[model samples]
Target: MAQQVNPPRGMRDFLPAQKLKRERALAIIREVYAAHGFDEIETPVIEDYARLHAGLGGDNEKLSFSILKRGLRQEQLENAVVTGTGDVLCDLGLRFDLTVPLARYYASNRADLPATFRAVHIGPVWRAERPQKGRYRQFVQADIDIIGEPGLLAEAELITATSAALARLGLAGCVIRINDRRLLAALLDYCGFNAADSDRVLITIDKLDKIGVQGVIDELRGFGAEFVTPAVKLEHILNSYSEAACAGDIALTESGIAAVLPADLAPEVTSALISLGEMVAPGLPAGVRLAFDPTLVRGMGYYTGTIFEIAHPGSGSSVGGGGRYDGMIGRFLSQSVPAVGFSIGFERIIDLIDLPPAADQRAVALIADKAVDPAVLLRIKAELIASGARVQIATRTKNVRPLLDRFELDGFTEFANVRPEHTSMHDLDFKVFAES
Candidate 1:
């Protein structure tokens, strides 16, 4: 018996058809982003271990895959074991997300880059997560970030470009759920949660979609008696909105945001969100909406201002998301530089969109009989190529149906049967493959 081999767990191998589909979708994303004035950039897959664990990636830091130091001393190994820490043994790690790498990239290349750099990055990131249906240890993220701009204009551009990409991909009914870390902080303050425990409380609140309102309250109550009152207050406010909070149907207007929260709590945050909505409203396509979701606490701790996630009716989870992380680049540059970014969840969106047929209708599969002269087949293929058609030569089989099906699966639109008598491209009759 032969031993079975496969790709590593939580990863995958794409077949020819699958790879073509993914690339076509990615090209559409790149085209849309470039038209929106975002320049594409790339970064190394691995970064210094210290930087990967710099307390910037939130929960994703724990899932980062670390690389062991090369040629480590036995003493170093023992020390790491005795200390029960991998930090001493690892010097680098695979990135868990693109935003952190983007921050580092901007900080390193600032002198050469535009003062207000608008970047588009599409690449793979690795995590050590337990694999699930929609989750993978390795996945791709498409991100557009604007650095060095401090105002709402950066946020507006990110939202506009991201939404346009989704619309171009034919993903309809996408709702951009907006919020702010400042608003979440104010809500926590109004609910009487201790400032120090805000992050932990927000982590639980982030689970409101997974666990119902009562479930979130229960988890917070378990934190301590001090959390009980705040948890209940939070629940009461959410309950007032009933299904609206869960559905994320709350309006984006100032009055709409105020109707659900404590008076005078982060009025500036509400105002900024309202203005953001109005700024992007005229730019977005029909069927795309922008709404306020006070419960939308994006899990990242680095978001200083606006945060949002893109939701689609077809997916149980957000198809994409990003936010303003003004403080992140400063951590690398030692100087404050305001930045905002939006990331399209590439893996998720690809599953939802069916890219239109390839524009080139000239892909041809030349099926040559085994008895056909090789020279004749090559001549015909060259002629088709010169005429602007993509041509592939395949030997004819007993049943050509299976061969034609394989060609169609590989993106060939038409097939031509070649024989000794077929001396020129015009001598062979070409037939289109039935739509799959």
Candidate 2:
């Protein structure tokens, strides 16, 4: 017997019904993207390994799927072997995410592209991570980005357009949480911490969702930073988003690691909060809530301005997130170019859309015997094909009832017998055959 085959763990195969549902979801996303004036473009799945890792900050180096080159000369193989660390070899890697490749593409071909390049790219991205419910090693990302427009309006447009996309996908009651790293930076500065410590503080606070509020505070204390603000002050700052209005009472606090903030920092933080409030408050849609969170330190080190994430309550994780990465393109351009965009985790959208599992079924099966004449078989197939049924002519000599039973088991309501009457192909109505 031949060996049984199976897909690698954490990978999935979408059958006809499931594929149809995914197509419907993609149609909604593409329609929304086109309606917003983003032109679609495709890129290659493979890229230079050096360009992939040049600007990606943080600990993401571990996530790369390094590819081995097989067509290398003796010297090239030696160089590749030298680079191997422990049991792992490194040379080329699967593109981790689409954004990095886009940055490289724009830099290499900026001359032919428009000044304000609005693009919609939807494709697969690979990450080697522990899989859980709704998380996969390989998945798809649908991204929309606009460059050469630096105003906050671009950010607002991303929020509005993404909200529209979700609504169209029947995911109406989603929450888009908004925050500003600059505001957090200013708050840190007001607390008398330097830039280096601020990065650490923001990174630590970013994990508040995973680890509770106290865990973040304890981690900060473990870092041995000077006590800048009281515990009450910290809690108030974190909890202020839930309140109706900001008040001065949030300023009174003196406790562990909280006393380090200067007295004048409160008014400055409050003023910045007021400015952001005016920008995001008026445009928010119904069933969506936008709030300023000090703890929303997006893991990407590139984000310079406003950062936000949209999450559906009871969903396993955030549906999608993107923000100002004004410096990523600068890495390739050798001169600073400001850019900001967001990516929709396509696999997550498919999961959240509530699609039924794809079941195996044949809408129209040719149950005729192998002894059936070739000319007669061709006529029946042509007739069924014209009727829009997926016709399959198999010579397995299986009983008709068994085939129909399998079709019924797989949720197919409509089935057609494409076999001709009395072994004659003479002038049979395919319409009647399809109806039957």
Candidate 3:
């Protein structure tokens, strides 16, 4: 029996056509981001184990793939097992997301960078979780972060730049659902939930889309008798707001925001949210929307202020999300530096879009007969290439139809049949595949 050959589970290999498509889409994203004044940066794929597990990554920390320490003796392994400290066996881990590595990079090079840094980082990250449809153990993330900005301008800029990237990709009907962490905490407080249980409760509420309002109430009831009344009141409040929104009574204005929530909630959070909505509206492309979603609890624990997710009518899940992690950089820099970012779900959006091959370079397939001299083939190829066309030499096969079809699939725009007598570019006649 032969051994099976395949890529590792939850990972993938891309064919030439697939790779081209992905590259084209990524080029558009990069160009759009650069035009918005964000400079590109890169970091190592692996980081110190302690930094990866430093609680800034939220639940993603648990999903990181740890790298075992080199040259470990048997006695060290035995001791680790005996002490129940298996994590000590590893010294580094594959980064599970780009944000953590960016924070580390900024901390290490703060002196050389600008006072206010706008960075674009696009790279692959890994996780050790069960894979399913549209989910993988390894994937690419396209992230844009603004560091050293503490005002709503950072949030507005992030949202605008991300929207422009999506728009440039020809994706329409994207709605950026926005909310502040402070507002979520205020809502939980208003509902009478204990402060310590807020994280767990928020995790459940983040599932409101997956589970209905009644489902959330039932789950909260299971926590304890104390959660029952508050959960019920929460259901009532949500239902009333839903009805008002349906009736067109609510808007993104300050008074409209106030009308929807409890009167006792802090005015500062609501004011900030309203200001963000106003700031981002003028910059968005046509047909893209910006709306406030009170139940929008991003799963990351590091988010300190505004948090948001991109929702599209065509996607069953969020296509992208991010938030203001004002405290993340401070953990490494030893001082507070406000920051915010937005990441595009590259894998998900790639599936949603179909892009044509890049048109800037012309690709030509040179089909040569076996009788043609090797010198003639080399000269023809060089001449075509010198004329700014990508040329590939293919020996004539028994059947030419399949060869032409394969070349077309590989993004060749035209093909030429070469003979022994042909010695110059003018002797070879090229025919477009579509015409053939």
Candidate 4:
């Protein structure tokens, strides 16, 4: 017997029904995106290692699937500086997410795209990491982005469009948790923290969703005594804020934030929070609630302004998230191109949805005895196909029973037994065939 082949770990083969379900779901998502004026574009799956290592993707960069340089000589492989080149093994790697490639695409084709491009990209992204339910080493990300827009309008459209997509997918009670990186920066300054501690602190606080307040405190203590004092202050402030927000007291959460912010930045922070609430409330479709969480701290290193996440019950993790990455594309062109984008975690959302019932499309299995005339079998097959039934033809013999079983598995609904000499026929509906 030949050995069975398997796909790589954390990857999967989509069976026919599964593929159809996913395609139907993607069509719904694309419709929602297209309604919001986003145009589709595609980029290559592989990118230069230099781009992947460009410090924009945060921890996702560490999980990049790098490939070895082609035709490397012995000296290049052995020597660290054979020709003033470092011992770099890989020159290219698979893209970790669509956002990176989008940025690169925009950089290369800036002259062709619109001044403010509303783009949609739905495709697979590879991440070399542990795979579990709703998480994969190879998965699809559906992203819609607005580039060259500086105002909060881009953020508003992103949030509203994503919420609409989820609602169209029949997911109710979804919450959008939002925050601003500038607000976080202001808070760090208010706490008398250094600029260098910003990202580390943001990464640490991002874990707050997994670990509770005290757990965060303990971990911050690990960063050294400098983090302990701010951690204590953060613990007090965030506890008070979360309680108030949970108790349905928005004003209290506001006051708590105002108390911690510096006098100069406090007013802007308060106003931005209010604007976020207002922008999300009016155009956003039903079944979506927006929350302003000061502790959001999304780990994407490139998010320079607003950040948000969309989550629902049973997905274990957020089904979608993205934010303002004003600086990411700028890295390529050495010029700023304001961009805000959101991505639906395509596979995660699929896990939560049930494929709606399919409409009736009757199928036929035309079975003939081996002793039957071959011309008769061919005529029956053509007739069944012409009569709007999906036809499957198999010879009747001792081995035919299992073939009929296989036919049923493939969704054939009716079975016909044809004879050459007797000029008689036997017919069975799919249910009777199943029982026999």
Question: Residue 19: error of model 3 in Å?
Answer: 0.7
At residue 71, give the lDDT of candidate 2: 65
TM-score of 1: 0.97
- Segments in model 4 whose C-alpha atoms lie over 4 Å from true places: 1-4, 78-87, 243-265, 358-436
TM-score of 2: 0.77
Residue 37 CA displacement from its true place in model 2, Å: 0.9
Instruction: Please provide, for model 1 over 1-436, each residue's C-alpha lDDT reduced to its tens digit, 9 standing for 90 to 100.
Output: 9786888888999988789889988999999999999999989999999999999898899999999999999988888898898687899999999999999998889999999999998899999988987899999999999999999999998888888888888999999999899999999999999999999999998998898788989999999999988888898987887468557688888778888878888878788998998899888987788888989999998999999999898999999999999899999877899999999988898889987667775799988888998988888888999999989999988988888888888888888888888899999888888743
Among residues 3 or more apart in sequence or in different chains, the pairs in candidate 1 whose N, CA or C atoms overlap within 3 Å are: none
- Angstrom error of the Cα, residue 415, model 3: value is 1.8
The better candidate by lDDT, 2 or 3, is: 3
Query: Sort by lDDT, best first: what order?
Result: 1, 3, 4, 2
| Prediction-by-prediction clash tally | 0, 11, 0, 0
Predicted model with the maximum TM-score: 1
RMSD of each: 1.5, 6.6, 2.2, 4.6
What is candidate 4's lDDT per residue for 260-355, written digit by digit as tens?
344566567567766767767777778777776677777889998888887676667887899999999999997899999999888888878875
Tens-digit per-residue lDDT, 1-436, candidate 3:
9886888888999988788888989999999999999999999999999999999999999999999899999999999999999998999999999999999999999999998899999999999979888889999999999999999988888999999999988888887878889998999888888899999889988877777777888898999988888888788887767544322235567777877888858789898889888888877898577877777889999999999888887788889999999999999977999999999999999998878756776899999999999998898899889999998999999999999998998888999999888898799899999899
Q: Which tens-of-lDDT digit does each residue in 104-174 have in candidate 2?
A: 77888789889888878888877787877787778888988877667676776777777778877777667
Lowest-scoring 10 consecutive residues by lDDT in candidate 1? 239-248
- Candidate 4 TM-score to native: 0.82
lDDT by candidate, in order shown: 0.89, 0.66, 0.89, 0.79
